[model samples]
Target: MTDFEYLEPEDTRAWVLHPELLNTPAPARRNAGNALEEAVALAAALPGLDVIGSEVVRVRDPRPGKLFGTGKSEELARSFKENEIELVLIDGPLTPVQQRNLEKDWKVKILDRTALILEIFSDRARTKEGVLQVEMAALSYQRTRLVRAWTHLERQRGGLGFVGGPGETQIEADRRAIDEAIVRIRRQLDKVVRTRELHRASRKKVPFPIVALVGYTNAGKSTLFNRVTGAKVMAKDMLFATLDPTMRSIELPDGPKIILSDTVGFISALPTELVAAFRATLEEVLSADLILHVRDISHPESADQAQDVRDILESLGVNEATPQIEVWNKIDQVDPEHRAQVISSAERAETVHAISAVTGEGIDALLATVTGMLSDPVHEDQFTLGFDQGRKRAWLFDEGLVVREDQTEAGFDLTVRWTDRQRRSFERL
Candidate 1:
């Protein structure tokens, strides 16, 4: 086995390939050109890589040893050599054998879609739990790729070892070693999950409804979150921009206070290992009182992308009964003619709202709709409290539930209109 770094220097020249397999079922095959563009964007997301070029390779007959036929493989090898490409990113799954063979033939490092995603996750995970989850998923992915003789299992940088290190010898990771690492990570992750559960439990006692934002990657979920909460989450025009979930308490206009959760964006064909590992992080969505399914209406493949998000939600066992509002975001990016059509279509559906988070267009109406959906039925009640019970009286006034107050000889008499949740909270106080 030969040991060598996968990537070199700070800027690795990279090429992206999206194989459009003609034999694949129509439902499973994505738009080849659009998929290629997304793959290029993903390559651009990583910090140290310089994407030189991209292509959509049409594959009529799949080859077992190498993904491409011999002549095509040689042609690509020549191009890679000429372009000085250090890495080739395939926008689909490649068998371990195929990966090894392609690397040997092309004389460059090969990363499949799963490995690239893992690398990005490793780079973007901020929280401790998120880091552990990405590590576990990377280990699971690396376990299978260990079949290749030139395996680089040691990390010399922030990202997972899938991308090469500088002047580092490749170390073969035995199954036992990988398994032990996984066990250690699982123990840490379990502790983190327990702590998160405690926090969630505390939030439940506060009577604030949770509204979770979920959508495909780079679909403006974080942007919408920032627009609504005024919190500076990393809202970028890149894939997997936000990895860890962020929560903020926000009061809807003339409505009940709620917790808004912005979670890691979903992607089409998300790695199964990651899906399982990040389940703990996504529990916020499962517990949400309402879900906002944000969509990039400007994207050509918007409908397909929306379906992909719905598929992931279903796989995560999100409650079908949970109320969902379709937020058609990025309307400003659409052409004026198309934008008008989008607005018209959204107007026809009560559950759908078309708005641009960046320009603040149609945001008030969306907020009003959210207020209406989250508002609970209110009833009037009278309460008598002594002057000494100032804290309870203050709580009612702060919540804006007091209808009227009258001073009395005993203490004070209050007429309040409040929801069941508020009433319960008041009793607890």
Candidate 2:
């Protein structure tokens, strides 16, 4: 008997299809070759698929019927048959009708960009909240494409595998099932979100400014995160390497400690499903005092990648007034001659820094910049704390704000040098 949970993944042969609209810029404004490369990388991120080939199909006008012209469709179908390709990954959106028609015409299981992203998320999510978010997103996406994808479940046989419920058609059952799953996942997700809010409130009591790292997929956010905080946070050279949000406290040289949050990487054409479902995770970005946009300076499409990150940030409601620093990373990958030019450009742009997270080159300057950005002009003041207010006094000293203390008969006299935020927290006591 086949176990449901441990079902083995089929090693299917796959080919990636990218429709490069020659007349229009892609969502990330990437050129055809770069777009195709990214699409292939996305496909490779998922397991159980041997991607044999990928191509850029240039189209002036997209078809609402088959996505590609009849002649091109027939040609690709012949290629698929020859390669025995079991799956075709369309690196673009497809209407339900077009998806169904293409699958029939191509005689292969087809996954649009959204579906492929959902699969990767489902596989990579580690936390409960991450899992629930991915599930809700997947369910929402599947709800739309159920017509073409769930045909296998259209069976009258009374069996366990993808069968309809009593007196219900397959589509009805699937819709109902999807609706129920979404509701169930949302219920669980709500609790997680609430707990996160409570945790955020708790973090407020700690009085550290939150700095969040955001970048395009495989742009080295995790690597920079690890280098800065000395935390082993899975710094892999892969797309969406870190799905879950991780936070750590890092102290600057001669400056106060701040919380640094490493978030999921932004991607070109991030699916609406993910954007909606991952809002809980993106909340960290919203609450950040500073956003560090790390970029792979060596990548050919780095400019387009930066634009895509900004676009996604806008969609997440990160306002224009928010403080963001551009970090031109991976300088180690650049040639010595070109590296000097990059450094010169970064020097010209005060907000941009050229650094290598791997080699720690230019990290001190970056940290000093971070310290400057987060520093609140601190002032020293004297305060009296009674014996009963030992907790408050301890909190002050624990924060490294207290410079000196004098013991008294009834209480203690403390001299504290701190920021406005620390002053507010003290006042709250």
lDDT of 2: 0.85
After superposing candidate 1, which stretches have Cα over 4 Å from the reference? Answer: 1-10, 148-173, 378-429
lDDT of 1 by residue, 1-429 (tens): 659757656799999999999999998889999999999989988989999989999999999878798888999999999999999999999987798778777878888999999989989998999999999999898777654344332231222333342332333435557788999999999999899989976875576988999999999999999999999999999999999999999999998899999999998999999999999999989878789999999999999999999999999988566789999999999999788899999999999999999999988999899898878688999979999999999988877888899999998899999875467557755
The alpha-carbon deviation from the true structure for residue 219 of candidate 1, after best TM-score superposition, in angstroms, is 0.8
- State the lDDT of candidate 2 residue by residue for 27-88, as single tens digits: 53467788888889998889888999999998778888887888899999999999999899
What TM-score does each of the candidates earn?
0.82, 0.82
- When summed lDDT is taken over every stretch of 10 residues in candidate 1, the lowest stretch is 153-162
Off by over 4 Å in 2: 1-10, 23-29, 148-162, 165-170, 378-429
